[model samples]
Target: MTGATVRPVAIKLDDAMKARLKRLAEARQRTPHWLMREAITDYVEREEKREAFRQDALKAWEAYRSSGLHLSAAEADAWLEQLEQGHDIDPPPCHS
Candidate 1:
């Protein structure tokens, strides 16, 4: 955020929610504003990663459909197991 322009945005919360936020902020020794900002940032980052993963899955599915090439589940599992056992090896070749 260095040298980046920031603008203030306002949100309205119910009384009970505001009280809860205040208590949590006090317990954490941070301002309510900081807590809200952190929450929003964490939510956005998580959602972004989830969306990227979904897009990648869609792309992979499309590629598989177009080419009809893939490794069986067992083949993929074996490759993963090898890697988990500290073996450095290529993925199993894809096939119809």
Candidate 2:
């Protein structure tokens, strides 16, 4: 962030919320601005990761629909079990 340009954005909060933020900021020995920035950053990062996972699932589903290739639940469970048992293993091949 050292070289990045930043702009100020204002948000309106109710009196109770503003007081709470101020108290929390004082307890944490931080500015209310810092707390707000951290909260927004964390939320954005979590949402981005969630979106990426959703996209991956959608892509996998599309691929499976096109190729009709997939593993049964039992097959996937067995592979997962082997990995959980400390065995280095590859996933089983997909089949129609």
Candidate 3:
């Protein structure tokens, strides 16, 4: 076992918790280990997606700031109306 990966991990749970895990594993038609691994994988994927969205939002804000562009209230309303009318307005140069 010299070159093999052998690591011991310990988890502490009460009888009720063990029973719940067993039931969950059975319901999912998986072993307890598979259930735990899948749950962890899903949680990490969700967190990554959220972080990516947050980063994209930040980039949009940064581009808006650096462009030093501001539209009047009427102009903004017209722009939105154009969008609502299905006009294919391009994104800002920086965003593009």
Candidate 3 global lDDT: 0.79
How good is model 1 by TM-score?
A: 0.96
* lDDT for each residue of candidate 2 in 6-62, tens digit (9 for 90 to 100): 999999999999999999999999999999999999999999999999999999999
lDDT of each: 0.98, 0.99, 0.79
Cα lDDT tens digits for candidate 1, 3-95 = 989999999999999999999999999999999999999999999999999999999999999999999989999999999999999998899
Per-candidate TM vs. native?
0.96, 0.96, 0.59
Best by TM-score: 2
* Residue-by-residue lDDT tens digits, candidate 3, 25-89: 99989998787777777999999999999999999779778885555566667777888999978
> Given candidate 1, what's the lDDT at residue 66?
100
Question: Candidates ranked by lDDT, best first?
Answer: 2, 1, 3
Candidate 1 stretches greater than 4 Å from native = none
Q: Rank candidates by TM-score, best first.
A: 2, 1, 3
RMSD of each: 0.8, 0.7, 5.9
